[model samples]
Structures are given as C-alpha cells and as structure tokens.
Target: MSNCSFCQVIDETLRPGGIAIWLMKEAKEDIKYQVPFLLAVYLDENVYNGALNFNPWRWMEPENEEKRNRRTSPFYAPFGGGARFCPGAELARFYIALFFYYFETTYR
Candidate 1:
C-alpha cells in the first residue's frame, strides 16, 4: 500500500534531497555500526511487508509506532551519548560546512 519511494531512492532512480550519495554513505555506515538497530527500523514487520517485498517507504506509516514515537518524542537520547559519542561527529560537521561553503562559492 506504500508508494515505494524508498525503493526508488535505494535503487538510485530517485533523489529526495539531491544528496543521495551523502545519504547512501551515512546509511551504509549506520548499518555497519548497528546492523540490528537499523534492521529494527528498516525491517520491522509492521513497517515492511516481508523480507522479499521489503519497502523502506512504509517507514512513514503510523504502523511503525515505535519508530514514529522515537522520532517524534524528545525523550529519546541522541545517537551515542556521554563518553561513547561519535568521534567523527565534529569532523563530519566541519566537513559538511566546508562542502557547503565551497559548493556555494563554486556554483553560485
């Protein structure tokens, strides 16, 4: 019953934010870091029909109650909190800002 936009995005046929490469890289890294957690969101039975007919677009559905709640609720903790926080978080932010700065200067 879903529109299957996530499939399109995954297949490289659709670019939601014009940043598919960035998204793909982040997704791949996330999967590597926490496969089970990512699967919990991406492979949940209620969000996806089956392993074969999987569709990540269904993530928008209310049926994914846990994910929806976590996304909307402020009670949830940030990814990697306290001393276990990501070491690359600051570097990633800096690189992203530099990318935007250069992109804007070069393109505009």
Candidate 2:
C-alpha cells in the first residue's frame, strides 16, 4: 500500500461524509472482483488488467491530461511523507536492489 497514492488520499480523507462514499466505491469495486471469484468461470480480464499495469513489463503510456491532472493533484502522493511514511519502504527497496544484484550476477 506504500506505493499506492490512492490509499494515502483515502487515509487523509477519512472524514464522516467522505468516508461513506469512499467505502461504497471501494465495496463496489471489491464486489466486481468477488462475484467472479465466487463463480467457477475463469474470466481473467479484470485480474489481468490490474496485475499487468502494476508490473514493470507491459508498460503503457498515460494520457497527457491524466498525467497533468496527477501532477496537479494534491492528494496524489505516491509515497506518504513526514513521520507517517511507509514502514516497509526501506525493506522493499533493499529486496528490489538485491533482486537486481542477483539477476545481474547470475545472468551475466
């Protein structure tokens, strides 16, 4: 969740009225994922879209307006700052560096 800007905004926007709408939207999205899982059908579109976009490979360009909007948005902190920052960030960075180190060493 550290890399999720949406989660950070969600944290800040945890007010009474705002929280209701946020939870409802999140619940709807979760239900979309859950209903298919309850059925035996192996529909993969949503799962694939979510995972592939998160992957380093299969990179897709963002729309120009979307990029500009993100740049201007105050709630778009990819990583939270100050004392409330992500705890596992350093560990994640270390693991990523180690993975690359091992990959380069072994593959070369």
Clashes of each: 0, 0
RMSD of each: 12.0, 12.9
Q: What are the lDDT figures for the candidates, one per model? A: 0.36, 0.31
- Count of clashing pairs, candidate 1: 0
lDDT of 2 by residue, 42-92 (tens): 113342233212332212224212311222322222233245345664564
Model 1 TM-score is 0.30
TM-score of 2: 0.28
Clashing pairs in 2: none
State the local distance difference test value for candidate 2: 0.31
Candidate 1 has which clashing residue pairs, if any?
none
